[model samples]
Target chain A: MELIDNVSVAKKANVYFDGKCISHSLTLADGTKKSVGVILPSTLTFNTGAPEIMELVAGECRITLKGESEAKAYKAGESFNVPGDSSFQIEVTDTLHYVCHFG
Target chain B: MELIDNVSVAKKANVYFDGKCISHSLTLADGTKKSVGVILPSTLTFNTGAPEIMELVAGECRITLKGESEAKAYKAGESFNVPGDSSFQIEVTDTLHYVCHFG
Candidate 1:
């Protein structure tokens, strides 16, 4: 096993969308890389605004957009497709952790 | 987006083998969950002993055992099957970061 500690890896740039931090980072490689992400626990709430970024919650969390389809539970270890330009609301019955990327 | 901060999540146990800290954390759920792990930058080395835990390094890292098959490169974002009981040595030509998990 090789351990690489204390080395500086490139950090993605962060863009702000209505006071929310939208960080984006591209891999330092050249190819069709696979998508992998981890959604750690946080307390960010989404309103009727930018909606491409969907929060992945765990443990019986429900997400329902006002006047949209039925409320759906964001199951643990499962993923939800983030609508690019739709305003949606996500409510978690408990704390959550989620990490994802667009490759 | 749900940001779940400041909440105490269950952390996994740490098992040390030969002065190495193998800290682990299981999700606060119960089921046949898919595996997800992040192998951040570390400086852990492998020798002619314990070799089940393979490190995933990026950027043309070459791994060679004492006397095994021809040395192969530990390509970035690509995974190498860690021989359960074979020992190996890794040499990275540059700094790196890698994260992977088994399901």
Candidate 2:
């Protein structure tokens, strides 16, 4: 996908998950909010409030979405959607770069 | 500035600065590459190879550009530019979230 050319970033917030994951939120011009983060090598589960599109910018991970029978491997440029009110499990083999878009 | 709606992420890379900072690179659709990173509370100096616009995505930091006698405080939503081949010093009082654009 091609994003627009101009962007205004939001104030920084320090979100730490036991030193495993770190991320900050950004607000777009139209007021759309998203987060960019990095995840270290670990297994983690996340619950979402809104439907989310998780795009992998770097590294690799195996993800098991809710109601899915098996985990799927996703690398950079790949993304998965998680329904709101559901949960997903992700296993990171190395550092992972990701952007989460909530809709 | 508003970024475009779609973007393809690049593979992740683990960049560690003696545990003070970590970041990964992403490539935009136009093949423009940028980096997102977090800096811990410390003072650090960096030399740049390309002209850079450092946007503060979160937190606060003080920066001293090359040839500058006094450092300036920049909070989230602010940014500073550095000329290529020059160096700058940054003092982070809190965890700093930043994205760097190379031109």
Candidate 3:
């Protein structure tokens, strides 16, 4: 994604991954926490405790939200929202760059 | 940074940082290794064993190559080359997103 001119780096930036995907967390000036990450080719499931907006910074992926019958495709510059306390599955055909905003 | 379509994620990505900066290593399809990272506001020095191309993906920083008397500033979309077996200093005034390609 293009750089935002006014964001402040987190004082204690940390990296998170489990070999399949990787990401770093940062806190903005207004105390909003976000993570920018890359997801490799895999079919993975994730559970969320908070609402999330996942923005596709690069590449593409197919996402199947909870209770959904079919998966949806999202490419670069697109985004998908997941409700709090919900789960979703992502089928990545290629390396995908994403920024997840959590609330 | 905008993700390249042909690049493949590394099978084994390990996070690296000393609380000042955070990055994850990825290996491309052609076996080239690259790192995507974020640097917080700080002045830090790094040594390289191989030639490196540091691409500024987001924010800005002032960099001083070894043996240089003055520092140069680079912003998003800009890049700088560092020679192998040399060291460079980076003065970051803001959160900086970067991708480092090693050869």
Candidate 4:
């Protein structure tokens, strides 16, 4: 497996996607291989309409699901599979971090 | 979306596999679909020699990687893609929980 760090991304993959700055560490977009990612300390503002599933790995994460009234709070280890086609903002609370879906 | 609580698992899944209790919440065993699961608080003593990777989702977790001198400690959000072959033990400390692989 290849090792990666935020530095690698901050130097190269710090770009804006759907209006949010995303540093693509590793992405398997072959449609055959699913995508796996680790959410870092970043604030994602609604840039486009794409629903996504997020799981809490560590720390506290605040996420506002599409068509939802209240924002879902996830603790470490907890997970939420989000649907694409919604707009929301993601904020990392207290250095919140998590491993993206990869099962 | 199907909501699952520990009670549902306690009433049903509580089996030992390779010397560990695994409550399969949702699994896509099809080669086309990757398997995804959330690890609960449990101790997995090496029943056989199957290598596996464990990521810390929440709380504190103690895991021993095959052929490693020291056990790797992971916090919530951090993830590890483990190989399925090296057998090991897993124990959740302080209600430690984790969202198993799902990408």
- Runs in model 2 deviating more than 4 A are A1-8, A11-14, A24-33, A66-70, B1-37, B42-44, B50-84, B88-93, B98-103
Question: Candidate 2, residues A1-103: lDDT per residue as tens digits?
Answer: 3333334333243456654677655566577877777787889988889999998887899999988989999988899899999999999986787888889
Count of clashes in candidate 3 = 0
What TM-score do all the candidates reach, one by one? 0.30, 0.58, 0.52, 0.34
> Which residue pairs come into collision in candidate 3?
none
* Top-scoring candidate (DockQ): 2
Ranked by DockQ, top first? 2, 3, 1, 4
lDDT of 2 by residue, B9-38 (tens): 333434565536766455565878777678
- If the candidates were sorted by their TM-score against the true structure, best first, what order would they fall in? 2, 3, 4, 1
Query: Candidate 1 vs candidate 2: which has greater lDDT?
Result: 2
lDDT of 3 by residue, A62-103 (tens): 999999989999988899999999999999885677778898
lDDT-superior candidate, 1 or 4: 4
| lDDT score of residue A19 within candidate 3 | 33
Off by over 4 Å in 1: A1-60, A66-69, B1-103
**lDDT at residue B39 of model 3 (Cα atoms):** 71
Taking the candidates one at a time, how many backbone clashes does each contain? 24, 15, 0, 26
lDDT of 3 by residue, B1-103 (tens): 2443333333122333433565655445576767667776789998889999998877789999999989999998899999999999999886777878898
Interface RMSD, per-candidate values to 1 decimal: 15.9, 6.4, 12.1, 18.0
Selected candidate, larger DockQ, 3 vs 4: 3
- In terms of lDDT, model 3 sits at 0.71
- Order of the predicted models by lDDT, top scorer first: 2, 3, 4, 1
B55-91 in candidate 1: lDDT tens per residue?
A: 3433446667657767676765566555544556555
Model 1 has a DockQ score of 0.02
- Local lDDT at B31 for model 1: 26
